[model samples]
Target: MSFFVSDRAPANRVSGYKRRIVLYCLGALLLLLVAVAMGAAIGETAIPLDVIGKTVANRIFGAGYTLDPIEEGIVWSYRISRAIVAASCGAALAVSGAVLQSLLRNPLADPYLLGLSAGASTGAVLVTVIGIGGGMVSLSVGAFWGAALAFGLVALLAKAAGGGVSAQGTGQIILAGIAGSQLFNALTSFIITRSANAEQARGIMFWLLGNLSGVRWDDVWLAVPVAVGGVAVCIWHMRALDAFAFGADSAASLGIPVRRVQVVLIAITALMTAVMVSLVGSIGFVGLVIPHAARFLVGVRHGRLLPVTALTGAVFLVIADIVSRTAIPGQVVPIGVITALVGAPGFALILIRGRRMR
Candidate 1:
């Protein structure tokens, strides 16, 4: 009886762990819905949650419900688009963060740390200020190219520094990323200062600080596929990610293609970051903070971590966007500002607690 009890205890513990993960995921989904509803309902002119539901239903399923033109425009055009973009961007950034932390073996690693955002900013600034792409190429295209370029340079520098995406090379990669970020950021500033007029520079500055007010269905469509695809790729590589947690040598011994997996995951993260940055500018800290919070809630296994991270990120950004719009009457704060204000303190707390644990 005692021997059977030991086996049963282990099985019971495993079951309990799985049950908790499922419960957390379910809770996250519910919170995401509530966040979306709250985002739609809390603007200058409030629309009830019921109206938001009806509006969405009517638009999607031809339900027999209606609203005034202004209300319809607010719900369908402005708020919904903003909410969707926020959710998508949040999820993309957070997942990128989670992957990077595992891939780099550094909990502090985030998407922007690799200079993607800076490169994207430089691209957008060039397009807006100097019209480098002429009228044919769009800002989004410029940003994507910028992000790709930045990633290439970072990888090059990291390789040159003797790390080259191996587990032992994480520190070199971080250093390269820092150098690239500074260089690109300076280039962005130079472009804005030298080429953009006062008014144009102001607009670029606003965009760089992260504005979601102008997001539309077009932006949402551009973001959703990239976000979904990147996340799916991450999930497919979950076992590889778990292996990497024990270091590249461990992963290799486990028959993982360490170098190839690292490159692929990094590329996926860069693509996700590029699309989101192009759509919403550089909204920081969602990547840095959300993944950490999700990891705390769901543990480190990518199987549980990724989905919960995505859901938490979406809900967090939606709520953040809502606060950005409503925090100051008659003026919308930049979403980046709000995130920084919230994330900086939370991150510091994480660092403090992490140090204490040591």
Candidate 2:
């Protein structure tokens, strides 16, 4: 009688795949840690990396590292908070961009493609310059309501224009987003001009350009959860998002419940974008450029694309924030300025390569 032997090659392959994924995850986490440390160490005060580490350790785990109070305060209270917020903001925007680009079937789709950022700006200006909230509602609260209003208007217009979740519907949504953005931007400008106060204009315009200087631990609490939750929600719909590549009809044919998936994901995107914009102002390019870069690196598979895109966006924005702080001798530039400088060229390259492939 021959002894039966079991084949374990398939098991080995499965184990190998799991090991590879773990390696990728570990590598990404290490990179993020290094980037965050750099963000804390290389700022205006130039804290040492060891001090940054000790501060973090002392704060998180009570390591008792006996660091200087000033250094610890700077790292723990200021730089670390800003860096983490940058990471959170970047991840949220990038995930939103990927979702919008997939759902809308538009290469240029971004978080602000729904007019959320513009409406948030309008709302913040109304509260700040026009005093619509009468010193009661905060800037973030006004921005959220404004974003909700703009989304409602855009939804109605898109529904009227195309009537269903079809190919035409995506196009109408884009057009509606553009129209809503223009309207809200005009409103923001009108309110600012009515105020006619250069100081307020200067301050709010700087914030509108994208400012992270005001970020703190409280902002971190708001930002990190939204980014993590947004990514988790997107990952849950990875299969549906992949099916969406062939258009709504194809997605529906694949049992995707196209309309429901679209609505849920779009709402998630809007919520993530509104929260981040309210926290950090409207920084561009993280959402628009990072997804294309991830797609280029990982191909078009959403399962692999979403997490990688979020990590890349987080690292890129942390670096951008660093640049914004140190790009000049004694002045901090708006984070948007740095992102635009990098993203414009990056997007041009993506378009050129895409055309060549076509």
Which candidate leads in TM-score?
2
Range of the 10 consecutive residues with the lowest summed lDDT in candidate 1:
163-172
| Model 1 per-residue lDDT tens digits across residues 221-306 | 88889988999999999999999999889999999998889889988998999999988899999989888888767789999899
Q: Residue-pair clashes per candidate, as listed?
A: 0, 0
lDDT for residue 161 in candidate 1, whole number 0-100: 97
Q: Tell me the lDDT of model 1 at 202.
A: 86
List per-prediction Cα lDDT, in the order shown: 0.90, 0.90
In terms of lDDT, the poorest run of 10 residues in model 2 is 1-10
Name every residue pair that clashes in candidate 1.
none
lDDT of 2 by residue, 1-358 (tens): 2232246667788999999999999999999999889899987779888888788889999999988899899898889999999998898899899989999888899999989999999988988888886899988888888888888888888898875345458888899999999999999999999884999999899989889998999999899999999999999999999999998889888888888888899999999999988888989988999999999999888999999999999999999999999999688899999999999999999999999999
List runs of model 2 lying over 4 Å from the truth: 1-6, 164-168
